[model samples]
Target: MNRLTLISLQVLVAVVVLVFWHIASTTTLIGNPKTISFFFAEPLAVGKRMVQWFMEGSIWYHLGITLTEAALAFIIGSLGGVIIGFWFARKPLLAAVFDPYVKAANALPRVVLAPIFALWLGLGIWSKVALGVTLVFFIVFFNVYQGVKEVSPAVLSNARMLGMNERQLLRHVYMPSALSWMFSSLHTSVGFAVVGAVVGEYLGSAAGLGYLIHEAESVFDVTGVFAGMFVLMGFVILVDWLVTLVENRLLVWRPKTSVISNR
Candidate 1:
């Protein structure tokens, strides 16, 4: 679809959802309106609460903390994932040796690690960053590894015949091959980075959007809870938009037959 058409469809979907939500929460559409409102909160009320939060400026500090944790996690986790993925893909024996261990690590439930991270790092941003890194690392690592492994054999042979050394091949061939895959996971990585930060904050923290939600939940303030969630969704969308701009710039030459990204 064209950009305008796609956006129009998206807006239509949002309107439908909001209308349904308003009917369910503010009127006797689904069942008792009071009970529904208690559970879900009126959409208008939540929107107003969101506006109040931004107007009062209390959310900026918490937003900043969450942003800091996510930024650190995305940077650290992506770097580690790319470097390690390259190493493993280039070294079969090394990969074989660590394959099971890597699988085991990835299989572990990340939510289970939140409290442990908090205990080890204290109830601070670092704990949140650590959790976020765990969430981001596996995604980028698998993509990068597959991108390198899927490099065309014919291209490799030609490069080898042209007298390129391993280091030169890696710089010119492997890195470029992996770039598309790396960028393809940008949105997912950004979302998970935010998730990790928020989950960590929700579990235990002095500040963050997640903390705001948790506080609201404790008081049975459904409007506040929904407002906090809406803020988080907007925050994530903003970050994803920035990531997309970077990806579009870097992959301006992405080809139709590129094996690096499914796109």
Candidate 2:
């Protein structure tokens, strides 16, 4: 489908869902109306709470805090991943020495590290950023490692025959391949970055959307919780779209597939 048609359908689907949700919560269209409304909260109520939050202007501070944490984590984790991944891929001996340790670290449940991070970094944004970094780093690292290692041997030989130095080979061949892989994992890493921040906040924090949701949940305010969730979803979608734009721009030479009209 065309872009406009796709967007229209997406909006229509959301409208239909909201309408059904309203009906189910307001009437006996599904389970017990009281239970449904109590558990899910009315979509209208969630929207109202979201509006109130925006109008109160307190949410901006929380948004800033969360975004800062996520942004820092993304940049740091990505850089570390790219550097280490390239190093390991280039020096198989070094990789062999650390391979088991790296795998073990990656295998560890990041949630367990939250308490340690909190102890070290305190309950401030740094703790959350640390958590997010751990989550994002491994993703980019693995992708880059695989990308560099998978470079075509024939192409590498050709470059060597052409007298390309190590740096030249990296710039022209390895970088392009690794970048493609790194970008592929970045979209996923963004969500994990957000999750790390939010989960850290959820575990312990005085501010952030996660804190807001936790507070609402503590008070049994389902509407507030849902509003916080919707806000988080909205931000994630916006960030993901920004990533897509950057990816498209940077990978312009990556080639594109043609789309022919069905009609």
Candidate 3:
């Protein structure tokens, strides 16, 4: 669909949903309408609260801290994943030996590690960053590792026949083969990074959008909670869009495939 058409559809859907929600909450048609205020605050009220935070409130400090923790975690995790993934990819023996260990680490629920991170890094940005990094690292690592492993044997032979050295092979062949997967993991990792940072804040810490939301919940301020949530969602969408832009730039040589037809 054209951009205008898509936007119009989205607006229409949103309006329909809001009307339905308002009716359900104001009437007894759905039963126990009193619970609606507890579960689903009206969109208009949520929007107004969001505007309050956006225009007159001091939400920027919290946003800044959350963004800092997420960004730091993303960078650290992606770098570590790439290096370790590349190392294991080039050394099958090591990959085999460490596969179980890696799986075990990834399988462990990361939330359980929050307290340890808080203990080591304290209830600061570092703790949140550590949590986020733990969430992001394994995702990127596995994708990169699989991407490298999936490289064509024929392509490898061709490069070798052309007298390419290990360094050249890695730079021109292995790395390129894994770039798509790496970017894919990165897109997913962005959300995980945000989750890690926010959940860490939820668990402990005085700053961050997560903390703001937590505080609001503690006070039964549903509108405030929704406002904080909307702000975080906005940031996540912005970062995801930025990642798509970077991916497009890097993968420009790759052909595009559109699933949607004009008709």
Candidate 4:
């Protein structure tokens, strides 16, 4: 389907869901809808709250904190992940030695780690950044590792026969070959980065959209909760778009797949 058609379908689905939600909440037909917080803020109420925030200036401050944490996490985590992945992939023995340890670290509950990070970094933006980094690192690491390992033995043999040095082979063969997989993980990392930052903030920060949502929940401000969630989603979408742009630039050598019938 075309973009327009997809957009129209999404809108229609959203509207239908909203209408059903409003009717169920406003009337007693569905039983005690007031018992749950979800029923309190219908689509219109959430939209109004979102508009109010847009009208006011508080949104920027929260948004800025969230964005900063996410960007930092994305950069630091991606860098660490790529380095570790490359190192381990090149040295299978070392990778084997650390495999269980790495799995253990990845298995640990990240939410539990948030409090420790908060203690180490303090109840500030850095705490959230650190939390987000942990969430993002493993994802990129595994993808890059797998991508590097997937390089064909025949390709390596050909490059070696052509007298390619270790450095030259890595630059021309492994790195370029892994670039697509790296970016694929990076796209997912972006979303995890946001979640880590927000959840960390919700657990204990004084600022950030997550904190706002936490505060709103404490006061039973369903509209505020929805507004914060919507804003976080918008930010994630923006970052994802930016990642796609970068991917397009870097992977310019790759051929585009035919999509529309006209092509």
Candidate 5:
């Protein structure tokens, strides 16, 4: 289908969902209005609360904190992943020695680490950044490791024939190849970075969108909870969009494939 039609359908789907939700919560379409409102929250009320938070400029502080945590996690985790991944990929004996420990660490549930981090780092942003880094690190690491390992022997041979040394080979071959894999995994890593920050904040923090949601939940303010969730969803989408833009710019050397319509 065409892009315009696709967008129209997407918008229509959202509209339909909102209308259904509004009817179900505001009327007896699904259940008693009061009961529905108590559980699901009125969409209009959620929207109004979100607007009020934005209008009063209260949301920006919490949003900024969350964003800061996510950014730090993304940067630190990705760099560590890339560096370690390159080292392990180049040294087979070292990779084999540490492989099991890496897997064990990666397999550990990240949520359980939140309280431990809070204990170690306190309730400050660094705790959240640490949580997010754990989530992002493994993803980028595995991707870069695989990318470097998958570099074609033929390509290496050809480069060596051109008199490329180890450093030259890394600059011209390994870095570029590993970067493609890193970028491919970044979309997922970025979301996890946000998730880690929010979850850490939710577990224990004075401020953040997750803290807002937790506070709302404590008071049974379903609308506030939903508003916080909506804000988080929007923030993740915005971050993902920015990641996509950077990915496209950096991966421009890669080829693009287009489908041809038989009709």
Candidate 6:
């Protein structure tokens, strides 16, 4: 479909959903308004709350905190993953030695680590950053490792025949090959990074969107909870869009696939 058609469809879907939600909450289409307000919350109330928070300038501080944690986690985890992935890929013995341990760490649910991190790092933003890093690290690491391992032997042999040293080979061959995989993983890692931060904050934090949601839940303020969620969803979408731009710019040399229609 063309871009305009795609966008129109998306907007139509959103409008339909909102209308249904309003009917369900304001009218007795599904349940009483009171009951619906108690549970699902009225969309109008949620929207008003979101707007009020924005107008009062109370959201920026919480939004900034979450964004900072996510950005730090993404940067630190990705760099560490790329470096370690490259090292392990180059050293078969090292990779073999650490394989089980790496698997074990990745298998452990990150939620279980939140309280431990909170205790160690306190309720500050660093604890959330640490949690996000753990979630992002494994994603990028595995992708990079696989990318390097998947390099064609013929390509390696041809490069070596041209007298390319280890550094030159890495610069011209390995880095580029692994970068494609790294970017692919990054798209996924961005969401996980946000998840980690929000989960961490929900578990324990002085300030954050997650904290706001947790507070609303404690008081059974469903509208506030929904407002917080909508804000978070918008933030994630913005971050994902920025990541897409970076990916497109960096991977411009890669082949593009077009969808052809048969009429």
Best by lDDT: 5
lDDT of 2 at 5: 100
Error of 5 at 49 (Å): 0.4
Quick one: how many clashes does candidate 1 have?
Answer: 0
Per-residue lDDT tens digits for candidate 6, residues 5-30, read: 99999999999999999999899878
Off by over 4 Å in 4: 1-3, 28-39, 253-263
Q: Alpha-carbon error at 251 in model 1, in Å?
A: 1.5
What's the C-alpha lDDT at position 168 in model 1?
91
Q: Give the TM-score comparing model 6 with the true structure, all chains together.
A: 0.95
Between which residue pairs do clashes occur in model 5? none
CA lDDT, candidate 3, residue 56: 70
Off by over 4 Å in 1: 1-6, 256-263
User: Superposing all C-alpha atoms, what RMSD in Å does each candidate have to the true structure?
Assistant: 2.1, 3.3, 3.0, 3.4, 3.0, 3.0
Q: Rate the local accuracy (lDDT) of all candidates.
A: 0.91, 0.91, 0.87, 0.85, 0.93, 0.91
Q: After superposition, how far is residue 126 of candidate 4 from its true place, in Å?
A: 1.0
List the lowest-lDDT window of 10 residues for candidate 5.
254-263
lDDT for model 6, please.
0.91
lDDT of 1 by residue, 1-263 (tens): 69999999999999999999999987776899999998889999999998998899999999999999999999999999999999999999999999999999999989999999999999989999999999899999998999899999999899999999999999888998886788888888888999999999999999998899999999999999999999998998888889878887887887645624463
Clash totals for all candidate models: 0, 0, 0, 0, 0, 0
TM-score per candidate: 0.92, 0.93, 0.91, 0.89, 0.96, 0.95
lDDT of 5 by residue, 188-229 (tens): 899999999999999999999899999999999999999999
Q: Lowest summed-lDDT stretch of 10 residues in model 3? A: 254-263
**Which structure is stronger by TM-score: 1 or 5?**
5
Q: What are the per-residue Cα lDDT tens digits for candidate 2 across 1-263?
A: 89999999999999999999999999987888789988999999999999998999999888889999999999999999999999999999999999999999999999999999999999999999999999999999999999999999999999999999999999999999898888866678888889999999999999998888999999999999999999999999999999878877876776465101100
